[model samples]
Target: MIQSLRLATALLSGLVFGVGLALSGMLDPARVRGFLDVTGAWDPTLAFVLAGAVTASGLGTALARRLRRPVLANSFDWPTRSRIDFALILGAGLFGVGWGLSGFCPGPAVAALSGRSLPVAVFVVAMLAGMAAHGAARRVLLVR
Candidate 1:
């Protein structure tokens, strides 16, 4: 019962996020492209969206930290990487390129499945393939 409730809450939160993204014009490819093309025709609207997201996420994390026990887990699994390395930089560059080309990040891509976008479907498949390949490569490298 508790597990089902947790899953329902998570799904509901994701649905709300997807609706917000769609309503806020973030789901439009042109808006993302405009934000990236800051040299010719700079559009700073996405900056406000990013700022608001960061603020809300920061506050939410703070609140979660104050809780004695997490509702769905033993504890939070926060990343310990404080310093950016070559792998991190390279991965980020690749992700940015993919985002610019497809205009559909992971969460939005899944959310867009209901919107009948063929290209989003392709992007999601390719993204999953890349992730699978990365995992395999990591396993191989770690064994050697």
Candidate 2:
């Protein structure tokens, strides 16, 4: 029952997120590319979108910390990573390159997949391959 509830909540959250992305023009690669084009016609509209997201996320996180236990889960699962490592830097750099080149990060990319564009499909495939490679590499490299 708990797992079912969690799954339902996850699906609902994804639906909400996809709707927000579509409404905010985040699902449009042209809008994202224009935002990144600071040297050219840089569109700062998405900056407001990003700021709103940060603000809402910050407030949500603050409220979550005040709770004794998660409303659905037994406890909060906060991120445990404390140290910045080489993998973190490399991954971030790669993500920026991919975003700048394709104008689609993971969330927006997945949302944009509904359009059925060949480029978007290829990007999603490449993104999944990178994620798989990262996990495999981490296991091999971290295990000594």
Model 1 agreement with the true structure over 19-43: per-residue lDDT tens digits: 9788776877778888888796878
User: Per-residue lDDT tens digits of candidate 2, residues 22-81?
Assistant: 999998888999999999999999999999999999999999999999989889999999
TM of each candidate vs. truth:
0.91, 0.95
lDDT of each: 0.86, 0.94
Q: Specify the highest-lDDT model's number.
A: 2
Superposed by TM-score, candidate 2 places the C-alpha of residue 86 at a distance from the truth, in angstroms, of 2.2
Off by over 4 Å in 1: none
Q: How many clashing pairs in candidate 2?
A: 0
Q: What stretches of model 2 exceed 4 Å from their correct place?
A: none
Pairing residues by index, what is the TM-score of model 2? 0.95
Best by TM-score: 2
TM-score (C-alpha, index-matched) for candidate 1: 0.91
- Distance (Å) between predicted and true CA of 90, model 1? 1.1
The lDDT of model 1 is 0.86
